[model samples]
Target: MERSEPARHRGQTAVAVVLRVLAAAALSVDAVVHARLAPGYQAAAPGGLGEGNLFVAEAVAAALVGLYVLIRGSRPAWVLALLVAGGGLAVLLLYRYIDLPAFGPFPAMYEPVWFFDKTLTAFAQAAVVILAAAALILHRRTRRA
Candidate 1:
């Protein structure tokens, strides 16, 4: 008789992949909206860079990562995914903890609500990145056994 180890539980990995895809989609949509519907809002943000450009870059990168997840097996794909998620977390932290106050006093060109809204958005994005990183790590370790 031949025996095989039980299949691994992959709920977290599935979740991580789904989140990555959703995040990518959301960023792509935001990019389109900013370019077509909210140019003023994009220009007024703290980065001074065009929000449309930024979001487009984000979306493209994320879509590439999603492609990797779909085409590759879990090990290599997870490594790449973790790197992407970790980079996102780092960017979010840098914006929230360093860039926000450094560029303080909210530019006269932008409305107060815009500043607050961007801040909240950065924090929320950071949370998602953090969650993705942790989930990837947990999923990796779980699958190794």
Candidate 2:
């Protein structure tokens, strides 16, 4: 049996709302972790575009994007969420595995260890990536539908 268009649309809307909330929550977690760790990292690498400043920037971006997704939940918002989370995740993994030297104004943020905050932030970023991707997929399908 086929579902009515309104019924299907309602289901999609519910799913989208859930995805948006989860994505925003994950972003909030990411923001909190970064903000909390920013001070120590700043002191550890005090300079231009230092590690602490980078952390503060990340936290601000995450919070803003999360707010956007929560309020708008548009395709662009989802895309931004994915990009922010994906970029953070990539950097996290890269710095975790390889000890790359400091480049330009960026400091050498290489720490080959899995601490609690780091692990938690990674998980939050990963969650945002997955949730935002799913939301974007739903947005595309809904547009087509």
Each model's lDDT comes to: 0.49, 0.94
Each prediction's total of clashing residue pairs, residues at least 3 apart in sequence or on different chains, is 0, 0
User: What are the RMSDs of all candidates, in order?
Assistant: 6.6, 0.7
lDDT per residue for candidate 2 within 7-50, as digits (tens), equals 99999999999999999999999999999999988997665678
The number of the candidate with the highest lDDT is 2
How many steric overlaps does candidate 1 have? 0
Q: Candidate 2: list runs displaced more than 4 Å.
A: none
Residue 55 CA displacement from its true place in model 2, Å: 0.3
lDDT of 1 at 43: 62
Model 2 error, position 42 (Å): 0.3
Model 2: weakest 10-residue lDDT segment is 41-50
The 10 consecutive residues of candidate 1 with the worst lDDT sum are: 102-111
Model 2, TM vs. native? 0.98
